[model samples]
Structures are given as C-alpha cells and as structure tokens.
Target: MFILVGITDLPWLQKLLFVLVLFFYILDVLGNIIIVSLVMRDISLHSPMYFLLANLSFVDICFSSITVPKMMVGFFIKNTITLQGCLAQMYFFHFLGCTEGILLAAMGYDRYVAICQPLRYGTLMRNTVCIQLVLASWLIGLTTSLVHAIMTSYLPFCNSNRIKHFFCDVKPVIKLACADIHLNEALLTNVLGFLSTSTFSLTIVSYVYIILKLMKIRSSQGRSKAFSTCSSHLTVVSLFYGTAMCTYLGPSSENSIEKDRIAAVLFTVITPAMNPVIYTLRNQEVKKSLKKLIKHEHL
Candidate 1:
C-alpha cells in the first residue's frame, strides 16, 4: 500500500521533469519501434545478432513502458497508486529488467561466436537456438518476477502508504513495511546479486574471448572491421550494467535516496533511448536498412 511522491519537491520542477520524461518516453518507444521494423523488414539483417537486437528492442520498449508512463502521470496528477497497481508495476519492472540483463549476456555470446568462430556461428546459433534462447530469457524473467512479487506481497504494510521513490520498486516498497523485512531485504540482495553478477560475468567472459580472438588477426583492417561491430555492443553492455550495478549491486544504504533515484532514471529512462542510437550509429547494416526504410515510407 503506497502513494508515489516522486522525485522533486517543487511543483514547477515536477512539471519540468514531466515534459522531459514525456519526451524521453516518446523517443524510447519510437526508437525501439523503428529498430524492430528495420530488423524485421531487412533481409540483409536477418541473422542471429539482428534477431537478438530486435528482441532487445522489444524488451526495452516494454521495460521503459512499465515506469515512464506512470511516472509522467504522477507529475500532473495527485500521484496516487493503489497497492495492487504498485505490485503490478514492481512485477513487470523486475521482469523486464531481469530479462534485459540476461538478454545482454545472450547477445554477448552471439557476438563471441560471430567474431571467434565465424564459420561455425551458423551451426552454433541457428534460428531454432536463437528462438529458444529468447524464449528462455522471457521464461526465466517471468518466474523470477513471480517469486519476488509473492515474497514482497506477504510483508505487512500496516498503515504505511507513501513510497519514497517515483516507482514501486521492491527496495522502496519494502522500506514502508511496519513488520520485519530483513528476510525480504536479504532475498532481494541475493536474487539481484545473482542476476546481475551472473549475466555480467558471462558478458565479460564473452568479450574477453572475442578480444583475444581479434588480437590473433594479423590484418589491421580485419581487426578494425571486427572490432567496430563489437564496439556498439560493448558500449551498450557497459551502460546497462554500470547503471544497474550502481542501483542494485551495492549496499543499498550506502547510497542516498536521491542518488538511487538518479541511477534509476539513468538505466530505466535514458538507456533504452540510447540503444537504438548506439546501434544505428555504429552499425552500417542497420543504417543502410534504416535509410531504405525511410525511402520506402517516402515512396
């Protein structure tokens, strides 16, 4: 049971944030939509990496939708959200968040294959395997989210109803409970730690292998070409995991609420919008496809 007070204290500042966030939401949604369209419509982009990129685009769209719309509404209205609504939001936020983390690792592995084992990549990450991996990420995300939601639902809120943060996250929601929440907090810590650490570790390992393989290339142009494609993925991985580590991987109490809120905004709001930009800028195939898409629409 909680009402979201949101981030700013001043009404004017809240209005400003609303406008800014609304723009971000629009950009995030529109950008992901374009990415999905480009990946699907372009036959040249029909590969394991683009397939996963499309999946990631869909995930980002859903992930940002879970919070940004509601958060923007809070600015103009009374900022009241029922307990049930809050729980639902919490469920989806974590669901998509966890899925994105796992998906990043999957994408890293895809990259490793493309760079390190170009010949066998087709055999290794066939269409069936790619579909299975995407399905697995969703299934794992949903199951983990359900467990977290159920565990959090059992906590006694008593009369407490005010959530300090803009969204209905587990950490902020659990802070309002009158009953003991040590178990809940511990569970959160362990679950989040495992999720972030395991996926991030995989990403790191994939990249390490990719780099080592690239170093073995004697041709400077070959190394440059290979590294260019990987640079976008690496940049995205760093952005997503860096902000996530700041928000979830640390001692929660060590960071102030303001800092935590800022970190949340970075990953939740900004990162999704940035993904398409990163890919489109760095990826020649994507850019070419997007250009054709634009031309097609104009025609």
Candidate 2:
C-alpha cells in the first residue's frame, strides 16, 4: 500500500480543497456529458468536427474520473492505495490522457481539412476515416499505457511507499521504487516524450497550414469565421499541452514534486472542467444547439 501526501496537510485547507475539487469534477463530468449528448442527438452536429469533439468530451469524462474521485476521497479518509490499485490508476490515467492527445491532433487535422480544403472536406473526413482515427488513438494509448503499467509493476517497492502527490501518477509512483529506475526514466522520457511531441507536432503543423490558408482569404470576415471555428479547439489544446509538457518534460527531481502537482491540477482537474465552457461560449453552433435543447425540454 502507498500513502498519498495529498494536496495539503492543513485540515481547513483540505476542506476547502475538497469543496473546490468536487465542484470542478461535477462540472467536468456534466459538461462533457451534455456535449456528448448534444452531438449524438442533434442532427446538425453530425459532422466530422463534432464527431471528434464528442469523442474528446467522452475522453475528458474518463480522464477526470480516473483521478479526481480518488483524490477527493483522500480528503476525509486515509489516502492509502493498494499496489494493484496504484498500478491500475496509473494505467487508466495515461491511457485516457494519451488518447485525448491524439484525438486533439485528429481534431486539428479535421479543422485543417474543413477550412483549407473545403471541396475535399466531405471526401477526406468521411465517417469511416474519423472512426479509424479515433480507433487508432485508442489503440496507441492502450499499448503505451500497458507498457508503463507493466514495467512499473515489475519494480520492487521495498523503500518508502509514500507518494508525494495526491494520486499515483507515473513519476511519483516510480520514485518509490528500490530498483534502478534509469530504464524506467528513459522509457518515460523517450516513449512518452515521443508520443507527446509527435501528437503535439501534428497539431502544430495542422494549425500552421490552417493559418496560411486563412491568410490567403481576402475578406476579413472570412478569416474571422475560420479562426472562430478553430479557436475553441486551439484553446483546449493549449491548456492541455501547456500543463502536460510542464509536468512531463520539465526536470524531474525531488524539488519539482510540488510544481508537478500544481501542473497536474491544471491539466487533470481544471482543464477538463473548462472545456465545455470554452467550447460552448466560443462556439455559436454549440450554443445554439444547447439553447434549442433547453427550449425543447421545457415544451
């Protein structure tokens, strides 16, 4: 069993943190569910873009669910997790996270095709193609997460089993291992790093092409419309990759645990909660659909 340090030691602060985290977790789950439901029910939203977005919303639900509930439970009870439980948490955490990363990249590509190659949008981003992209993302995420979980499980944990973070994150859990962690660290740096960098690169490249296309449009309104279409996605991507890179790519050491925890909160807890707001407020189509749903329900 491993004892989690949790977010704070002060009883008063712990209460405050619990209330705040509960609020955000509820918001995250409900907002994502609403998005998923909207996309599934609304015929107008049955496009490649919305399909990818609904998938993203679903991933967000699972991603936040993996850690937040456990973290919340730690507030009132002893923050102890069993060996198997820790590994399972680590597995699903990375699985959903990696899947979301790749899904975002695919969303970027969908936007790129829709805006830049309008004529080919229907043909290029057909239903089968989008389904394949989602499936590929899930397969890749599963494979990578399995490797991490299996490798970390093999490490002997004869040392202190106290995790410095609120949950069983890869870095924090691996730090408790008695065995040589150089290979584990290398895998974290190389395998996970490649996944992050490659998916991030894909998103960047798609946006680059998208921006160039927008520049060619003579009408300011055309550019604005195009930019608006992708703004929500770009915002979400920035929030996710920014915190994720800080946590993973930054120097790992005892001194950085606090920083990692903060970064983890941003991506894992805050970002998911904010996604629906970002999409709904910025996206006219989504807002309209939401309003329609609300009005119809009242009748």
Candidate 3:
C-alpha cells in the first residue's frame, strides 16, 4: 500500500514539489475561473467556439481537480490508495481524458465551420448544434472510459498492488494483472487508439484547409491575421495531440510507463493550465471581452 518512487529523496525536494504544485494549482484554478466568468458575462462571446472553450475550462477544472489534489496530498501522507479507490480514480481519470479528447474534436469541427465556410458558419454552428456536439462529447468520453474501467477492474490482479507511478492508469494497473489482459490491450489499441487518432487527424485536416483558405486572401494583414489564429490552434493542438499520441498510440512497452507519465503531465495538467492563456493571449475577442468585464466589475 506504499509507493516507492523517489520517496527517499531529500525532504526539501518534496517540499519544493508541494509548493510548486500548489502554485500551479492556484494559477490554473484562477485562470479557468476568469475564463468561465468572461465567457459568461459577455453576450458577444456566446459563439460556439467560446462555448466549447468554456466547457473545456469546466473540464479542465474537473480533470485537474481529480488528480492534482490527490497527487499533492500523496507527497505527504501514506500515498497509498485502496484497490477500489484506485479503480475509481482510474475510471474518472480515463473518463475526463477521453472527454477532453472529444471536446477537442468538437472544437476542431467548430473551427472548421468558422474558418472554412464563413458564410454559413453561424447557421451550421447554431446553439442547438453546439449543445448536441457538447453532449455527444460527454457521452462518448463517459462510455469509452466506462468500458475500459469495467474491463480493467473486473480482471484479477493477484500479483502486485504496488503501482510504481503516481496515478492509476489502466495500462499500468492492468500490466500488474496476473490474469491475461489480452482483451485490455486489444481494447486499448482498437477503441482508445482509433478514437483518439481519428479526432487528431480531423483536427489536422481542419487546420490544413484553414491555412489554404488563408493563403487565398489578398491583403497581407488579412492573411497574417488568419494565419495567426490558425497558428494558435496549431500550437495548442500540437502540444495536446503530440503528447497524447506518444502516450496512448505509441508502442506499449515497459519503457512506456515513464513516457506516459511525462505525457500525462502535459495533457492532464499543463494543457488545462494553458487553455485560458491560449485564448487570452492569442484571441483578440477574448482579450477585449476580458477587459470589458474587468472594467464593468470595477464600475
């Protein structure tokens, strides 16, 4: 019921980790709060993209809230979670991760409509459409992770209970299974891989056409501005999809534990932290709305 990784390190290092993580946790919480607040207050910001961003902020808050607090607490106490506790964490963690993936895909589709088909963008990404897309994202994510979680927990793990890593990832936990996890591996490959890769590919294709559309513009300012927006999405998507593909899609081997661990930090922790920053820094509308909100608050 104990974790042994780096526990022997100096007390100061543990303190540093706790302090650093606390700082980031605070920042992420505040950032997401401001994002949700700004998006809600501004009627002009009621578009589909920002609506999706708001949902992502909500997801970001939930996703990090699930793991970060536990991780930070584990640094001090027993750091040992019960078997059922482990299963619950795995279920929710996988669930949120899958949900976030679908939200990203939904965001890509939103962008495709906005950028590629400007004339009919509003009609295509109407309120009802947005609601349905968001609903579908939630359902898909929940269903996908539920299957994996059930499949994993139902299997017998008689060999070892000591998970080397911090979080309860399905593959790592299943790896400890004394029973055959061939089905888990197959599900991971066929279900998780197919869903994640397809979304990632769709995002890539969306951006490609957006870039081509930007190229056809005559004015340099118009082209630069269009490319700039695309660039921001590209940056965010690259950080997300790159880490994700490495973690889930790449070869499943013993060495992949650390790889996924690192990737988890990016996709689960840092990317959520970056979502607000992405909009505030890159998108002019979000910045203007934020400024207006602050001014009104002061008034």
Top TM-score prediction, candidate number: 2
What value of lDDT does candidate 3 attain over all alpha carbons? Answer: 0.80
Q: Which residue pairs show backbone clashes in model 1? A: none
- Considering TM-score, where higher is better, how would the candidates rank from best to worst? 2, 1, 3
Better of 2 and 3 by TM-score: 2
- Tell me which of candidates 1 and 3 scores higher on lDDT: 1
Shift in Å, residue 273, candidate 3:
0.8
* Error of model 2, residue 34, in angstroms: 0.4
User: Model-by-model lDDT, in order?
Assistant: 0.88, 0.94, 0.80
Worst 10 residues of 3 by lDDT: 1-10
* lDDT, candidate 2, 1-299, per-residue tens: 89988988889989999999999999999999999999999999999999999999999999999999989998988889999999999999999999999999999999999998999998999999999999999999999999999999999999998899988988989899998988888888788889999999999999999999999999999899999999999999999999988888866798787899999988889999999989999999999999999999999
RMSD after Cα superposition, model 2:
0.7
lDDT of 2: 0.94
Model 3 residue 121 distance off true place after TM-score fit, in angstroms: 1.0
Q: Which residue segments of model 2 deviate by more than 4 Å? A: none
**Candidate 1 at 233: error in angstroms?**
1.1
Query: How well does candidate 2 match the true structure in TM-score terms?
Result: 0.99
Off by over 4 Å in 3: 1-10
